[model samples]
Target: MSDAREPVTGIEVPINLKYEFTAGAALARFLSSIREGRIVGQRCPGCSSVYVPPRGSCSRCGIATEEEVEVSDRGVIESFTIVHIPLPGNPVKPPFIAANILLDGTDMACLHLVSEVPTERVVVGMRVQAVWKPREEWGYTFENIAWFKPVEGA
Candidate 1:
């Protein structure tokens, strides 16, 4: 005997709460740098680990990071995945690549979208660089750098 499946349905719930999020000291500076088409990382004097998107303190040594270090825009893709699923409010369309990149001179990796290359061509160790939006479009946010793309001649 064969079994039949039942149809499932649910009501659409919409959330409309108004709220504001403030990025504290370290993060605020990091975002500001991004807006200016530059990337800055904070160095942990104790352990010397550099964090992109600058955390106020070091995760390993538990000491506050104070030195602002400029990091290279180009980096190697440590890991990545080609996404095929679609979701509401996704910044990019489906079938895009999301990557974890280790910016040059930094100790940690930052997650961001990778584009300008076919999904099949993306791989771990692929060199990529930030593709920033027009200067007028920048703000104190991650949106400043539109996305990352493969570095030419690399």
Candidate 2:
């Protein structure tokens, strides 16, 4: 018997998914602050750890975080990786710096793009600051900040 392969036809199904969830009380406040060009964190009364993008609850002590604290836009890059390949839906273009930054006076780090500096020059502990988009573009999202750039004299 001769081995013959059958061609398989692929069917593409388009699915449109739409759903929304309330960010809850804590996160809603955090998002609203972002829309207003402010960075806020909640401090845990138990451990005194501040969380950017506040969760309203402390993972360490299992207690609710109540005190809202404004953090600096400038932060130190805790780690980073340069993307060399293009991927769909990537906000920043290829060959961009994606860094985990620990904001000043906060204990947690967040992931964001780093621009205005050479990728090769990106280093851990390097100070960076948010490069916000036009004020008109600020909405109920973090996209208001276009990307982060290294701070001068930092």
Maximum-TM-score candidate: 1
- For model 1, name the residue pairs that clash: none
Q: Tens-digit lDDT track for model 1 on 78-98? A: 999888998778858889888
Per-candidate RMSD vs. true structure?
A: 4.6, 3.4
Q: Which stretches of candidate 1 lie over 4 Å from their true place?
A: 1-19
Candidate 1 at 108: error in angstroms?
0.6
lDDT of each: 0.90, 0.89
| lDDT at 72, model 2 | 92
Once model 2 is optimally superposed onto the true structure by TM-score, how far is the C-alpha of residue 22 displaced, in angstroms? 2.0
Residue range with the least summed lDDT across 10 consecutive positions in model 1: 1-10
